[model samples]
Target chain A: MRLEPIANPGLARSAGLPAAAIALTVVVASLLALLAGADPLATLGLILKGAAGSKFALLETLNRATPLIFTGLAVAVAFRAKLWNIGAEAQLYAGALLTVLVGTQLGLPGPVALPLMALAAILAGALTLLGPVLLKTRLGVDEVVTTLLLNFIMLLFISMLLEGPLKDPLGMGWPKSEALPRDARLPRIVDGLRLHWGFGLALICALGTWVIQTRTTLGYEIRATGLNLQGARFAGIPVNAVMVKTALISGGLAALAGFSEVAGLKGNLTLDISPGFGYTGIIVAMLAMLNPLGVVVSAIFVAGIFVGADSMSRAAEVPTYIADILLATALLFMVLAIMLTRFRVVRG
Target chain B: MDLIDILLSASFWAAVIRIASPLIFATMGELICERAGVLNLGIEGIMVAGAFAGWVAVYAGLPLWWGVAVAMLVGMAFGLVHGVLTVPFGLSQHVVGLGITMLATAAAYYAYRIALPEVTTPPRIEPFQPLDMGWLTDIPVVGQALFGQTALTYLALLVALATGLVLYRTPLGLALRAAGENPSAVEAQGLSVTGIRIGAVVVGSGLMAVGGAFLTMSAFSSFFFEMVNGRGWICIALVVFGAWAPGKAVLGALLFAGFDALQIRLQQTGLGAVVPYQVFLMVPYILSILALVLMSRRAEVPAALMTPYNRGER
Candidate 1:
């Protein structure tokens, strides 16, 4: 069988394929649930109810999705330029570390400290990614491996600092940073709601990313560079410069996830601030087809599965890892579905 | 002990070989995949699956060798998923590989939870025992280090040798190399490029699974989450460090394992009190990045490494 590219796919074919992919994922999930000796339909129903059945659950999902949105945007932006920045996990840690340092040491007023904390976080994340991007552009190294290796390195660096200089004195033996003061903490989105302003910031970032991708010259250059490097170079786009710029933006965006998790949610930095949000961001970006606007929906969707699955695992006696398996299957099937939208398979 | 004493000790050298064993199997696995023009980023996840599958198989009363075979079969199954998507569907190898990794890892974890729902501590099994060469074992540091390891370690060395021999000395190897280097040429020769590439990935993935099995069945007696921890990624770097040659790749693994063993020993020395242990743990990853940068300019990557080939496409 050979796949032939379709000149133009109709809207129904494009949309229908993704819908079919989701259905396939549901089928896979059902089979897994059956194998685990649970009522498949009830398990799925419980997941759906647990995700958005109550205001608290919905709020929980929004809180979980805040970091994912940032990381998803980061991945989407970087992947658009073909930079393949897989070190968002490292960059997130850098941001969190810087946020904690600024929050604990600066002793500034709330209005002044919060923005400063964000700025520091962005700078740290950007700097973290800059090393790998520079290596890729200058040394012809693969950013995928370099960035990935940095994740382990950054984790160890964080562990060292936490155990040594950054160790919290007031709290007995825990390897955690000092709590961010009330002033440094992020305000809630609403007075009575459980959600924080981080969710709002994530939305704003998603919108800003959309604008940058659609209405800006840098965005055009990024798409051009990703599509064809030599062609973009011949067309007078500064390919290397664009890649570096994309890295800065992507890294900075991913770092915001750390900043938000530290300041908005946890009010302190811990080793486990992210439950693989950086990695999950890749799934979000791909599920959204790398579209900036679509990241919000995908992030929320991914977060809902995790949140729902966590609760479902408690009530249903199933492992919470079902969330991961579901999302992974969704990502694979979705990519294949997206491919099929533009191509038709035919026996040669 | 001081640095020199640690270096001279047979235990340290044995530790190096033990650490290098998994890397050897995985590196050779990755080498074959890349040589056939598929990146197989699913290696990390596949290794995780292999580790879990092998341990669980043993825990379920299968023989140790049978556990190893089970791991290989599971690894190949994942590989087939990777191969089908990247080779035939022509999806982005990067996305598909990561997806596979996530899927395999999640499935393994889920299976573990289902299999041992109430167990807090990961259950341990009897692991591979070291071979005794009675007189050889008495011969000093070199003898014990070389001959005292479990059978899996020896198998790792033998696999590396076989990989070198098969890749450089066989027609099948030539076809696999051509699939990566010049697919059109292989197609012109009437050989199935798709078949050769997929076959390489399947076989290579089986070896990678064995690497993971070594962790459970030899290096450690129990399976744990995060056991495979970036070893698969490091193997990818080792491939570049070795310039895609099997012999050099095995050497790269040994060199890395040497650094690893030295760091573990250093953590117990006087210097361990001054420098944090995390810093020592950081050495191998930092070395991998450095190795990539150092070899980047000189290393000749397979020409069609990440590109997907469509029939009749220029």
Candidate 2:
């Protein structure tokens, strides 16, 4: 089962399995589209151009990328401790809900209201992660199931809130919450685009996560446990604490993503607030090889594809699902590639 | 309808049966796969694919039975893909399975969008009618609940019994168990671990396909995007509750189905209950985590559950 590995870490290291697989995926996806009568090269060109060709397109890409940065860092942080926190979607929603509830309900001044709302949102997300973390570390239950199942429950809760508790009275019958006070809104950075301070917050979080992951005592213990649990235990690293802490941080970061969406863009929570940012974060983390800084870069790359998908849908008469297909293909290749990076292959 | 009247109605039982039926098929399929030491995480995808393929076939003028058969075939193909990815490719099973689920979901959506015009409403077929046992109608609640269900509902229960017999009483079951529990020892005894597991997954896929087809053809009567919902993941939890036993898994599925049925029923009653529906919606997952935590302490995992088998190693 040992796969081929390239020992050289340099950029010039000639084609490895990861490279080959990624190239294969791009080729295969293009060929598949080409078979459907669309020109492969042209479609790719359209995708690239649609995402980054214009001043507006670049802003659109960054705007789409904002939530991903937070969630990607969320996933990467927890993954470092080998605690798979898959409930980022729920956490994000819960955070958004709390943020909206606070923003709309409390009419505090600009300075105090924003920080309190952000704090409340973070706590809401962290609270959601508590259930899974407790089940995993205390009861030895699999967090994967708990986190995933919680996602549905959280979605249902979100739906219920929009439909019942928080329904806007002014709207014609659509399911959405009341808009937040103007004072609570994040100042927009772009003149004519939706890009705002949330992207900056995500960037800051990524930087913070990078520092925590590479330069802290807790980070050392977390990585130790992830690399080798038994060895970590033998070395007196508190695995349980590290796992819990990682899950909490993961949940908090995801919640902040929710907060950003509410504060920066919408000013109120709505149904379908997230377009699967939480799920996409997993792909982003893996694509980055679980590096925090890499998550920021990969998030931007993925955001470009997403932005591109919308254009492809309008112009090429192709479904926007190509983003998912490409990502899946990239994931498969990257996983194979990353594994190869770890071990060398030879004839038995 | 009055409270007692609603409780005693045939339609109420029918609704319960409809909800329970698909979970039964899927949970049993999951039981077999987990018992064989391969947790096929692609069940969600396979089920959705089956639902779409089954509905499309029926919509395109195929017989109902043939549509179900096509669903099973597609499921097997998906299972084969999963098997090759996990068994041969040696990828992380969870990651591969997750990727497959995402890919299948996206593919299913695109397929639906492409096949049908955006403005056109999707087609729906007449759902399979429940079998009415004319003589057994005299038997009150038992007759209404058991004798008046869809063919798939009965099949699900019968399959559970059949799976139990095969897994617990047959020599084939013993060999399969040995393969999962200790693949190297099974290999030493001249058994093919890969073959047994692949077979298990393929069969499991077929069972899961039936579950999906049941969702479309029997329960809802049409395929929709994200139709399988979270049922596939629920089956993963059910596998733990079942302790890798078919009978136990079926029981767990029934419990979840009952909870689900009750949730819907309660919502419809307009009882104005104080408890949030979301909390109740979380019942299955919450119960599963609680059950797993309790059972895993006392229960046993297959010796080689998550480990990839290397033919010549050890």
Q: What lDDT is reached at residue A120 by model 2?
A: 95
Computed on alpha carbons, the lDDT of every model, listed in order, comes to 0.94, 0.81
Provide candidate 2's TM-score on chain A: 0.95
Provide i-RMS per model in Å.
Answer: 0.6, 2.4
What is model 2's DockQ versus the real complex?
0.55
The DockQ score of candidate 1 comes to 0.93
lDDT of 1 at B218: 96
Shift of residue A11 alpha carbon in model 1, Å: 3.3
Model 2 CAPRI quality? medium
Estimate TM-scores for all models: 0.99, 0.93
lDDT of 1 by residue, A96-122 (tens): 999999999978988899999999999
Q: What tens digits encode model 2's per-residue C-alpha lDDT throughout A1-348?
A: 334445665543334666787788779668656645677888888888989999888888998899999889988888777788778999999999999988888888877888889999999998999878987787778787888888888888888888787999986788888988888988888666768999988998999998989999988988998888889999999888888788778999999989999999888788788988988898888888789999989999999998987887678867778888788778877786666565455553
